[model samples]
Target: MDGRPSFLIGGGQAADAIARIDWAATPLGPIGQWPQSLKTALSMMLLSSFPKAIAWGRELTTFHNDAFAPILGDKPQALGRPFSEVWVEVWPEIQPMVEKAFAGEATFIENFKLTIDRHGYPEEAYFTFCYSPIRAENGEVGGMMDTVMETTETVLAQRQLAVTNAELSHRMRNALAMVGAIATMSLRHATGLDEARRQLSQRLAALGRTQSFLSGEAAEDAHIYELIEQSFSAHPNLRQRIDVVGADFRLGSNQALALSLALNELITNSIKYGALSKPEGRIGIRWDCAGFRFVWREAGISGVEAPSREGFGSKVLMQFVPASFSGQARMRYESDGLIYELEAPAAAIDNT
Candidate 1:
């Protein structure tokens, strides 16, 4: 090399490395012998703040700027190496693009996918880049220059956003369908206009309350204990009268909504006629972890009887609530008080 060639003067580490390396040992022989085209291309590439690389001469010798180092990651030394061999893992996917550049065709692509193994493990990556031909003094295509920027994180983020939007749309439709069903059942089961108006208003209010208390994953997961607390929020006076017995455990969005609604119905009935109506009456809610059983037991009431006709509240407690967790429910009305029991696998209520 002639002391410090003019074309190798300004670029940081890349310039230093290119000037310091013994070019006589590489395929291009010596730096003094390098074509003006290669020298000019290297000078411009090395000076750029953006990531850039050039594959010059017959060997397709690689030369890159300091900004391009991170893209190589923990790969083998790439400076002064053949571009194709330097990225052999992804060469099969990118070779055609390289060929296009050398054939005097410049190509610009966005978010191009390439699976590479630069850090000892295969990973999918994306990049937006332009590969343009470099011309020799004779006007022949001498090599190619790559101007690139990795877009892996941006691409993945966009895909995740799409998925989240789709899930929100699906959840919204399901909630609307549930609201429609609740309205229909509430109006159908009412014995009188006054009862229908009260029932519909209360049921809708309970549904709104369910949305307020649930927390965690996708805004739908919650503890069984929390569901109970929220259900009893409207009846602070009766809360002390009722006894809660259960292990606190998380339930999915569906289970949380169903259980809270069921508990709300039970509370409404109790306030109007069952345990909460009489001062001495008491209520107990027990959920066993060993076998997965949720039992609601009432005590200290008389003349409790099955409803003359099924209501939306009954359907929620006896059918929809248990069915949400892939289980069965039974409701019993003895002369003393009402009883509701539901059984299902723990897995059914926990899976998100």
Candidate 2:
């Protein structure tokens, strides 16, 4: 026999590397002098397809199989180095666990987070692993065995899912609050079933339009012109009478949603009672991109008046929509026509 331990034979690339290494230069001394216990443990470790490594004796020298290569990523050669040196970057975090293993305690951890410099830059990573004590011929704890698998991808996916679920829950709660408020208002003042139904429909339509962009199907930010275009798409006849003039640009998600809903409420009011209700009715929409101001004007109509009692639409225009954009809104009930204006800090208008 060549006298080489059988574990050093036929381990594929890792085995070839082991045979070429000079054990005399290391703390483990020469290959002929290795303990039988270590040789047997290594033989079993090399035969398995699992990613594992052994850190042996006072030097904690490292020995690993071909299956352990991916765990090392682009790390320097680690075959015969001290275990702590091989993972020096994370030594502080893992030192306790290593100590525990050598102290005859078996430690198992799942999705343990770490920051490593594997690919030339530091990045977050996670792993699931076990560190077990390896016994010596005298029945004393002599070394440690590390059996590990990367779990960075699975951990990140779970975090993303948790964030998505939280956002969905928050939105549902806000929507339910708005619906309950509207229902209370309608029931308190509703004169008849038809009137109550109409009020709820108008407000719900505005809310529905708000959700179209917030539902993740649409871009997070939308242009001013797109919001106006979508709000009036169903009213082809009124759409022709309206003139929109603005230096169009994208608005942040919150601003876009508020503007879209407010525009819908305005369009509904004009159709039912303002200029759009008359054949000679005309409407003008303009935005001051520099000053962050918007105006809706109705002309060629007479005797337009505000509702006697403030309803859900009133609350949306005067309170909710303006508050959403950190702005103020004004509605004029004049004999000539109805005019509405909203203004806010230019910096606050389109955050994106």
Candidate 3:
């Protein structure tokens, strides 16, 4: 012995492991025989707060610090093992980088993916790290030092946010197009400028209500009964005049929007001229199935007749809304009242 105290005398757990290593049985030989350059590098790595490790000599004996131990996970024995064995799970992916470092070319990778067997099972991980050559006294690259930081959480969060932003942009474009269509149709059907303005404003407000409901974080598929109830929430007395009966089911986002718009048109017409135009009139709405089959019935009104010309409300209820779901709609204007029926596949309304 050189009669010197151990190099790791007051170091942390990783340093203590290195001190207990049987250096004489290893390719690196005894600590007393270690080169001054290797000793200096090890001393610096042992004191680092950042996760770091040194792979020394031709054998690439692994040595790391307390901060780096958790990175090894279940493989605590990695402290004195060969670097190749300690990280065998990702050797194929990292071998080229390690070889480059050994050749005196430093390598830096960000958000690098590796499937590692670190927690007693294989799991994917992302990292940002650098591998730089460690030189000997003769100025030759004899080993490599790794400084690493895990970036898995940060990378995943950014990716998720990007997806959400893309979806929102698409929805916004669709909404603007719908608004343009509603304005054009409303103006064409109005008898005068004031009538056009009033009709446009009412339709826009209806669109706004539907959007508000869908914008909620907890909003997913909407319940059929809840959607109908929401449409009449503004008119408490109207609730008593409306009879809703059917097995309730959820409507997908697009389906909910279409149905809400159609109902708004129907309700508006009824309150102005149809069944709900008189105190004695009443309305009944019913639906069923995964693919909804709906019926709207109005009664207690007399001299009901089909309009001479189809307007925006007629096209929305009898054509556009039905076509959107690849379904069919029918309307009958009997002398007693107007009855509307729509049939579409449940798949059209299933948001999930």
Instruction: Point to the candidate with the largest lDDT.
Output: 1
Of the two candidates 1 and 3, the one with more favorable TM-score, higher being better, is 1
Kindly list the per-residue Cα lDDT of model 2 for residues 1-352, writing each as its tens digit: 4555687776767877888899899889888888888988888888879999999998999999999899888988898999999999999999999999999999999999998877788889999999999999999988899999889999999999999788778777877787787777766667889988888887677677666755754445777887788788768767889999889888876677777767877888888888888999888999897878899898988888878887666777889778877889999877867888998888777555
RMSD after Cα superposition, model 3: 3.3
Question: How many Å off is the CA of 47 in candidate 3?
Answer: 2.9
Model 3 CA deviation exceeding 4 Å by range: 1-13, 16-25, 29-33, 217-220, 300-303, 347-349
| Candidate 1 minimal-lDDT segment of 10 residues | 211-220
TM-score of every model versus the real structure: 0.88, 0.84, 0.87
TM-score of 2: 0.84
Q: What TM-score, to 2 decimals, does candidate 1 have?
A: 0.88
lDDT of each: 0.86, 0.83, 0.85
What total of clashing residue pairs does each candidate reach? 0, 0, 4
Tens digit of lDDT per residue, candidate 3, span 1-352? 4343456645588776777778898888888889988888888888888999999887888988889877888875886688999999899999899999999999999999889998889998899999999999999998899999988888899898898888778768977988999999999998999999999999999888887787772254587788898788667788999999998777776778888889999999888878988888899999878567899999988988778888899989988889777799999987778899999887765656
Segments of candidate 2 deviating more than 4 angstroms: 1-12, 29-33, 218-223, 233-242, 249-254, 278-282, 299-310, 333-337, 350-352
Model 3: lDDT to the true structure: 0.85
Candidate ranking under TM-score, highest first, comes to 1, 3, 2
Q: Choose 2 or 3, whichever is better by TM-score.
A: 3
